[model samples]
Target: MEKNLRLRKNEDYKKVYSRGFRFYNKDFNGLCLDSKNNGPRVGFTITKKYGKANMRNRTRRRLKEIVRLNRDILPNLDIIIVPKKHTYTMDFNSLNDSYLNLIYFMNKRYKRK
Candidate 1:
């Protein structure tokens, strides 16, 4: 079974969003960052403005699926995905491609030490 990388706390989310580098792609939202030696982790952001509880969780689940599926292609960097309200309508294929592209984009910007 594959594990889902997760952002667990308010501080962690804030650090990734405010301090970590970001990419806002047409189909996805991303924040890529150094882990300061704790290895890679990930987080998801879905606001109530997106919809009710189900909608928010659905966005999160989709993001987690994309990341989990492409784990091997990714580098050792923290990531966060903040879904736009329009994201709920996106199909899995678009989400997958967009997410993988975002990961590749991040990989290009940050070289492992």
Candidate 2:
């Protein structure tokens, strides 16, 4: 993903975590906050509990790809994805499916608000 489309600052992530709506699943947590930008911005968080550097990086890449593929469906929001340990074992297709499900759930929840 491009740098411009990423949530970079610590404050940005905190804002989303504290004020945004959240969705959780077996593999990841999704937090979404309304954004001023015209396009969605995303961030990924993977800790040592998931694995070593390489494993965590792999998980981030997979998540990024999933987001890229579904960017059209995502609204103009700041989204933070926090991956669980099981996320490291999921293949790309499974990861994509799970993330999409969360995105759909998020959209539905946001619409109700």
Candidate 3:
């Protein structure tokens, strides 16, 4: 999971949280995004509330894959994916769609504001 393409560093996380605009969908416990111009970066967070170590790791892996796959469609925006308690039971396709859905939501949110 740590070696995943979309995973970000500590400093990157801080920058994204500090500088990026955000909007999330309810189905996504995780985030997907492209790095911004030295402004914000993509990021992810999985709390203990998600599950045990394996489950958390799985969620991270799923997010990384989905983000990596959709890299082209995303913008240079910072994204932070947080997992829900039930995230463990979700299938990969659902998890994948969650990222797209959230990004869609964010794009719409940005368009409005």
Q: Model-by-model lDDT, in order?
A: 0.76, 0.85, 0.64
Q: Write the per-residue lDDT of candidate 3 for residues 1-113, one digit (tens) a residue.
A: 22433435787676656665656556654343445454334467887776788988877777777777787666555668776777678898887777788777765555312
Clashing pairs in 1: none
Instruction: Give lDDT tens digits, candidate 2, residues 13-110.
Output: 88998998888877778889999777789999887887899998888888888887788898778999898888788788898888988888887787
TM-score of each: 0.84, 0.91, 0.73
Off by over 4 Å in 2: 111-113
Ten contiguous residues minimizing lDDT sum, candidate 2: 104-113
Off by over 4 Å in 1: 1-4, 111-113
Candidate 2 vs candidate 3, TM-score winner: 2
Off by over 4 Å in 3: 1-7, 29-41, 111-113
Question: RMSD of candidate 3 to the true fold?
Answer: 3.8
State the displacement of the C-alpha of residue 86, model 2, in Å, after optimal TM-score superposition: 0.9
**What is candidate 1's lDDT per residue for 1-113, written digit by digit as tens?**
14335667788778887878878778767887787544677787777778999988878887777777777786777788777778789898987887877777888876555
